[model samples]
Target: METQLSAARVSIRKGKAKPFWYGHPLVFSGAIQKVDGSPEAGECVDVLDQNGNRIGWGVFNPHSDYRVRLLCLAEENAPDYAIQDLVKRRLEEAVLVRRSLGLPSDETNAYRLFNSEGDRLSGLTIDCFGDVLVVASSALWVEKYRAEIEAAMRDVIKPRVIVWRQVNAPLRQDGVSEIIQTISEETVTVRELGVNYQVALGAGQKTGFYFDQRENRALIRSLAHGRSVLDVCCYTGGFALNAARGGATNVVAVDSSAPAIENAKANAALNGIEDVEFICADAIEAMQGAEGANLVVLDPPKLARTERDLHRAIPYYRELNKAALECLGTGGLLFTCSCSAAVSVDLFLEMLRDAAHDAHRRISLLKITRAAADHPLVPAFPEGDYLKCFLVAVA
Candidate 1:
């Protein structure tokens, strides 16, 4: 642990310490009243309250609207440590939490090790795919101490390959350019609940696989016996394969990405799952075409990245879900989801109601679930719970 206190002191505006005290990590630029010292971009800063009382420690960024991402709070006296120590400490705690939850066990080797602010490491997410670890950083502070972060990961995980990827750099809001790329040598094969999958590592979407849906896939498998299943947006066929494994009478997986469809085919071949059909097509159109799937999985990508996107996104969600509901019969089941943090569970439920009305179908809500245990979220922070999965019984 580095023993030097940050040179800069940031004072929060009047009455703006409530959320900070409540463990919220975000402090927008508007909440700051003044800066006591000139701090460089991505520098650690001491956060003080309106009355100049020490609140905690946080990472500073001038270019971004988010002025500070709180590293940790000072319950008593502020700790004398650098950002590296905070990161490593969080990493160890996160690993212990996952281990307690039985992640990377015999049945599963792929999962989210650290979930952004959920694990209190704001703007940093690390997912483990077998021996490979994909580290995604969205904050400049993370980039400033990239070496320290990597070193901590090495010390904690000792992973075979660590692929660093940049995502949504807020510093690039100006005319500055942002380069987004991933470094991976080869695809890795991983297992989840006894199902084997060929993960495309960094090249695939959001670290190649959605391990957040691990428990949801298990639920699908348990309910898929003797059903005609349709998996839309089947990225590498996670749910589709699980459905087939669960003894689905007929399985059809569709995705717009040709590479994803090909990879899904490879995964099917890897598991000797010959009965599942893989299709590369538009998901909404495919859902409209398939009129009689008893079990349908509608797991689409993040539609509303931010709150501003809800207008355009709500219609898309409604249309997609309406099509999925239309594809189901009287006794059919529908597993729908929204990965957008901006779309709250209540809003998603309202959209589903509208969708069912549009599809002219009666729906009974069976269950509601979020991400798996490994992807734990802070209940105080609503955005931390990004995944909203709904299991509906169509009648």
Candidate 2:
């Protein structure tokens, strides 16, 4: 741990400590009354109430609307609140939680090791693809403490390669690190539930794979026996391969990305599962052409990037889902999902209802699922629960 230093302090606006008190990790700019000292961007700052009472410690960012990301409350705080110590403890805790669930077992070697706010390391997410660790950081504090973070991860997981990536950086140059780029290599083959996949750590979407859907893929396997599955937006075919492994009569996987379709085919070959038809086409158009699949899964990318995008996104979701529901045979099953944190379950449910009505289909909700155990959620942070899956029986 680093030596204790007298850090800068920021006072919360009068009566604005309620959310922080309730365990919400974010403090918006509007909630801050004044800064007691001049702190550099991504500097550790002590959070104080209007009355000068210590509230907690947090990372401060002047540029972002979310000005402070709370690290730990004073009551439950650690003895040494150093960046390295905090990161190591949090990483170790996350690993232990996953180990408790028996993840990275004989059947699986890929999973989320650390989920940003969910693991209390706000704006930092790390995923494991076998020996490769893919990191995505939104917090500038991570850049300053990058060496510490890597060291802690090495102590816990000895990953062969660590690729650093950024999401939504203000500047393109700021998004990437030259040192990390020089050290990191590209692709690695990983397994999940006995399924083989080739993951591109530096190039692939959101840490190369969606390990959060591991349990959901198992659910697809359970329900796919003897059915013809249609997997729309099947990036590298996570669900389609599971369906094939589960003895689906036939599996048709479609994705707009040519590379993804090619990778899906390679994964099928790697798994020695030959009953899949990989198609590179727009998911909406492909869903429109579906031929009465007994099982249909619609897992698209984040359609609504922010709350402001809901108007445009809702209609897109409705249309895509309507097409999928229309292609489902009577008594078929549908595993539909939306990964947009901006989109709430209530709003998604409403859109699904409208889609079913448009498709002239009767739907019975069978199960509501979310991300796998590795991506744990903070009860106070609704944004932490980004994945929403609806397993329904359609007629």
TM for every model, in the order presented, reads: 0.95, 0.95
Provide the lowest-lDDT 10-residue window in model 1.
Answer: 168-177
Give the runs in model 1 whose Cα sits over 4 Å from its true position: 1-5, 76-81, 169-180
Per-residue accuracy of model 2 over 74-168 as CA lDDT, tens digit each: 88667535888788888989989999989778889889989988998888899988888888876767776789889888888898878887665
Q: Give the TM-score of candidate 2.
A: 0.95
| Residue-wise C-alpha lDDT for candidate 1, range 6-112, written one tens digit per residue | 55899999988888887788888899999988887777888889998887888778877888888888883435447677777899999999989988799898899
Model 2 residue 333 CA deviation (Å) reads: 1.1
- Model 2 has a clash total of 0
> Clash totals for all models, in order?
0, 0
Compute the lDDT for candidate 2.
0.85
Colliding residue pairs in candidate 1 = none
